[model samples]
Every structure is written in C-alpha cells, then in structure tokens.
Target: MTGKIVWAAWHPRHGFEIPHFYDGAVAFADIDDAVRLVRTLNADDKTNNRNGWRAVKTILVRAP
Candidate 1:
C-alpha cells in the first residue's frame, strides 16, 4: 500500500509553529518505511541544529 507523510516543526518555548511538506508529500510503499524516515529526519534535524527547527511529529495517511 502507498501512503503520504506529513510533518511539522515547533519551538519548545515560544510555541511558534512551522508546517512542512516534502515536494507535494512523500509517497512510501510501506507505512513502516515512512515512519522510519520520520525518525531519521527528526534525528538529523536535532543533530544538525537546523535553526532551532526540529521535526515535531509525523502523520501517516493511506493514499486514496
């Protein structure tokens, strides 16, 4: 099955929010793969310290 992944970023203290999309949503063959990618991106963002923006959550949606 195919799915779409959605992610967002937010600050810890300020409560500022940033919505992110990956070139019209990312398509994955398996939901597990999509979750793995989310974890990887989150980890990378923390490691890289991308302007204090870190991946806060991921949503998985089955393609229609």
Candidate 2:
C-alpha cells in the first residue's frame, strides 16, 4: 500500500552556522517512533555539546 513515510532528520550544526555532517535519514513506520528518536537524538546532541536540530518529516511514497 502506498502511504506516507515518517523520517527523523537530524541537523548537525555549529554554533554560528549550519555545519555539514554526513547524516543518514532514519525512516520509521510510525510517527510516534520517529518523534521519539528525534527527541532522543536531539537530547544526546545537547548533552554532548553538539548543537543541532531534529524533526519528524513525512514523505509520500509509491508502493510497487
């Protein structure tokens, strides 16, 4: 079935500007799971002094 895919996008950034980082988008079947991961990742980044952003995104996909 074609449906919306949930993804957790983590933005790793420097304090001043957007810093480039080799990041991978993680897909989740549920929005709750994606949000959970985003929170966990952003919290970890904060604790490690890695200032960045994280969000839950959705994309429509076609099922073959």
Candidate 3:
C-alpha cells in the first residue's frame, strides 16, 4: 500500500506558502498528521524566533 505525499514550505517570518520552489517538506501517512506537523512547526517557530514558515500540500506522482 502506498501512502500519500504532502508538501510544505518554510520561510523566514512566514507562516504557510506554496510548495513550489521549496525543497523542504514534511510527509505523513495521514493528512491529519501532516496538518498537525504544520501547526506544531508554526507554534514552535513563534517561541524560537527563528522566523520560520510552514505549509502543507498534496502532490501526485506517477509510478515509474
């Protein structure tokens, strides 16, 4: 069974944005988990003052 692939972006002083051009992303078997991660990252960034951003998107890939 194949799992779903999610894409997210992290930027300075940004919350969430399009995954395009972003090489960094987080993946999860469940969409809920992916969302949770985004929220977690956002909250973590707030305290760390790293000025980070986090976003999530689902991507479709064809099997080779």
Candidate 4:
C-alpha cells in the first residue's frame, strides 16, 4: 500500500504563504488518533505562536 500526499496551506505572521505536503494514510482507525498524528507531524513555527496563525484549517487531500 502507498501513502497519499496531503497538501495544506498556512498563513504566517508576515502574511506569508506556506504550503506543506504530508504523505500518509488519512484513514486511521480512529478519527482522534488521526487528528493527533497529523497535528504532531504538522507542527510548525507558524502554528506555535498564539499571535501567529493557528494550525492548518484547510487541507487539500490528494489520492495516489
């Protein structure tokens, strides 16, 4: 089985655009676990600061 590539966008403090690609199976056994894993792996500088933009909200899913 091959993992898919997931794309996500992030808006930083300087209004800069940031995009990320995550390759993995989104079909986790549990939604909570999937979310947690995504959150951890997706952890970035922009999402760290309270003043900066929060975590990724819109994720572009790609099928492989």
Instruction: Report lDDT (CA) for all predictions.
Output: 0.47, 0.53, 0.52, 0.40
5-26 per-residue lDDT for model 3 (tens digits): 6554445544444244344444
Comparing 2 with 4 on lDDT, the higher-scoring candidate is 2
lDDT of 1 by residue, 1-64 (tens): 6545554444353232323434433434555555555566556556333544344445566558
Instruction: Report model 4's TM-score to 2 decimal places.
Output: 0.28
lDDT value for model 2: 0.53
* Candidate 2 lDDT tens digits, 1-64: 5567665554555322223333444566776775665566567666322345555466647656
Instruction: Please report the candidate that would top lDDT against the real structure.
Output: 2
For each predicted model, how many residue pairs clash, with residues at least 3 apart or on different chains?
0, 0, 1, 0
Question: Which portions of model 1 show Cα errors greater than 4 Å?
Answer: 1-24, 47-64
Question: Which pairs of residues have clashing backbones in candidate 3?
Answer: 13-51
On TM-score, the leading prediction is 2
Q: Is 2 or 3 the stronger prediction by TM-score?
A: 2
* 2 against 4, candidate with superior TM-score: 2
State in Å the error of residue 32, model 3.
0.4
